[model samples]
Target: MVVIHDGYFTDVEGCIKENWFQIDSLLAKQILCRFSLPFNKLAIFTLYNNCVHLSAICILINLFHIYILTRKALRTTSPIYILLTAIAMIDIVSLSYDIHTEIVEVYKVFKVCYSKETDYTIILLNNIMEFIRNYSRRCSTWLSFSIALIRTLIVKYPLNPKLEILSKPKIAFYIIPTILILSAPIHFMDIYKYQIVFYDENFKCTQFPSYTTLYYGSILSDYYEQDDVWLWKLNRTIDAVISKFIPCILFPIVTYLLVIEIRLADERRKKLNQSSIAEKDSKNTTKLVLFLTLPFFLGELPIGLILLTKPIDKLREAIGFSLFTEGIEKFFSVVLSATTATHMIVCVFMSSQYRESALSFIRCGVKFKSQNS
Candidate 1:
């Protein structure tokens, strides 16, 4: 059992001292005497392996996007096409730091660095992680908002009546600004609220500070005063509404309405001029919306309910939905994967034009390499 001090776990200094001494005496010597060089080499290999794996995947995805946009043969200049690129760009940017950070942390794991500079790196990395988190959350909100608004417009107003007027990037003009404005509040989430914990083999970060730990530490005890507690609860409540329920409800309703409008439009078009292609397009759109959005709704519901209600039953339900039985760390990862998968699937599947372009690009590159040989 340990106490708390300032904003950190109490006795952390002593704990770190004991751990470092143990590392130096037991693990360090053993590692050095038997397999130090080989171990270091292996760590480097693993680091490179992970970096290359992530970087390569990102490159491939981006290359595919580029191919689709550039290819004249499959030029699809639709609002949905633009949305796909926007989502891909977000993923690429988010992944750029994420992959590198993972690689760096993995490398550090083999040879731990606990100096002031290490702390700085940790701070920088933590901030980047936070930025990525907020950025991703904002992206999700915006994506849903955009799609919902688009569907709303298409359902509310047919394009044929005002075809020329609606073609001027209606979605981008409105949704972009709304998302930017709505996401502004997230920047206020400071690093000071939570203390980082190094436990077991890896450091497990927690959003909620242990009350016992906080009470022991003056800084944390002061930080977690009644006012702060209320604020935190309020913020959590706001997040539940803004990030989860609103988007979940709005997206489905808008999508349903849009589907109905599409069906109606198809019927009208068929009566006017029988075209199987238009019918196929409507079916594809319906499928695309359902496939992309259902996972998000499923993933968020349990977590959102738990957070909002905080009932034991609800919390247990959320835990059941969690991917791993390993506790909070695994829970966070599960939620993240589930949420991001929605965006990823939508971006990839929505634009068939992009896929064709990407495949052709890959083939050409392989051909060029073969010819060089």
Candidate 2:
């Protein structure tokens, strides 16, 4: 191994001091060789495999969820159910898009069906799907917060019609559109932030690129771009606020308020000796709100806080882009997928109305199959 320092070929380990820490070339080589697998391949492989399994399960369960939710008994029950259905549908679309992007990535990463020039159309479609999935995740986040706040308000003020406007599907007809409009810009810039650079088919990505090895496409993102640094920072600031800061801050406060209201509601029930089935259902609905909203908050809270910390110069400079930020993003993407998956189970376990509807749907399905048979 050759070690070059300050325009001089040296075999010494003493001059390898960088900033605060000093590391020998042997150690550095060892570090690089230990993992062996290139990050580009590792990140994509891990994300692709996990997303395939998790997204498949989430899509199937959410399809069943939407079916059960649209039952006549549950459809008109409340706007909360409407929101739940929207979340489920978006989850399906998002996961499908994720799968689409990964499929293209398999071609891009593993160098399958190579051509003279890079497949811009395929790569662009992959980027579009990535952005759309991101937007869907954000919309899901905001919708979760909306439901939490609405359920809390309805519980806190049981008789306030104006405040409960959002709790009604008719009154809040624009909510979904509003969320889509607001969160659309967050990923718009990201589309232009990356593009495929490595295109040559015969050119080995590394010394000898084969299966389970170096990356095929090496696209640089905005964080690596040196031009217009201020603009990137400004855009990232806005993204952090819209996509991370506000929702993360408000979700916990809303959760606390919702939990408090649930307890107070229980106390009210005890005081009134309200043992009626309707009162029992009301209590269950309140708990359902907690169950639905809390998962997204918990799943996203860690990553949100970490992303928020990117603005801090010291921390960001200390931990460079790919290893820390990219890894975290991939991990949390799966976390969000898993969180959405739990919604089906959450609805089934907590909402008695949903349980009844699910049973009815199951019976209808079995009867129809028997008749067809």
Candidate 3:
């Protein structure tokens, strides 16, 4: 969502990331009335200032993550690496989209692009970025879940030939596409929910006197028919169930199983007084997946809770007046951007192969710099 001139358009629409909510309808009217200059600054800082730096850092980190995973040692270690490589790529795209929208908002906020007429293409372009951001963010969420599930299965059944398909790195070639295909349907609803409209007659911007007319994109209730409203609500519900709540639930369960299995494996190693490289690799993989899922699980839990209340009629009524959803939703953008940022650190600490390669990568950079100097 882009914020320009005294307008707040769009919100954290889904559980994993944002979809689209507009400023001209539903909660927007109340927000516009209650939140003025100070609040707008707060909203601005909350969404833009926080996300820009964090998102940029994460985008760079995710690039490194994708590159580091390409090392033959790390790549051959587990299929989780392949899935992780896919997740890192998505994270980079998602975080870059986050920064792009924030930059647009910053430009629109301080700069006067005065227009007596509506600019449909501007917000439409923002809508396209929102579409890609939400889609890639969802892909990251599902792939993280896939990693948890796959790693659990591989760790638990270390000798099952039935699970052999999952152990192959090439399976990610299949899994990534499957996730992209399956996670796509909900994002198609973006174009229908919001559109750019000219608010010339009723435009009110007391804070900014540079322009008399305001052309902003918002989710207008008037744009929806009765059936369309129901469809929109249904889509949100389905998205919450699939995107938000399910992973929040599954991550913990799979994490618990991984911990139990790894603990048991460690005890077995101690008893045997012997540890094979394969066994060591298995434990390390468990640790990597364990650390990997933590951020997603913690990040998604509160979002899932907010989504749980969205369907309740009483809470829905209160949401119009309450800034609870607004603050949390904007904060979610930063959180989503920072999700993959932690993975690199986790890898350096937990996964031996990644640690070695990461050191090697750093050394190569230093050596190159020395030669250039």
- Candidate topping lDDT: 3
* Colliding pairs, model 1: 3-10, 4-10, 4-217
- What lDDT tens digits, residue by residue, belong to model 1 across residues 1-373? 2332332212334333444123446554344324322332333334332444544465455646644654563333445445545555665555565566666667555645344345446655656675675566557556655755554565457555664433344445455566666776754553344444433223332444233222111122234335636555565566666767677678777778877777787778778986675456545655555565666665565556545653223332332212112122224334444344344445446545445555567587353221100
Error of 3 at 369 (Å): 21
lDDT tens readout by residue for model 3, 1-373: 2224332323323211221222336466444444432343464466656667778877888888888999997687577888888888887777777677677666667755544343455566767787787778778889999998988888788789999888888878889999999987876765576656655545555556555335564463444435546655665677677888888888889989988888877887799898677776677777778888888865676666666666555544443323445555556655656677888888877877777777778888443221100
Ranking by lDDT: 3, 2, 1
In Å, residue 116's CA in model 2 sits off its true spot by 4.4
**In model 3, what lDDT does residue 146 have?**
91
Off by over 4 Å in 2: 1-49, 105-111, 116-118, 164-167, 195-228, 311-322, 365-373
Estimate, for each residue in 270-316, the C-alpha lDDT of model 2 and write its tens digit.
Answer: 89987777767777777788888767765577667666666555544
Superior candidate under TM-score, 1 versus 2: 2
The regions of model 3 sitting more than 4 angstroms off are 1-44, 47-49, 106-111, 114-118, 201-213, 221-228, 270-272, 319-321, 365-373
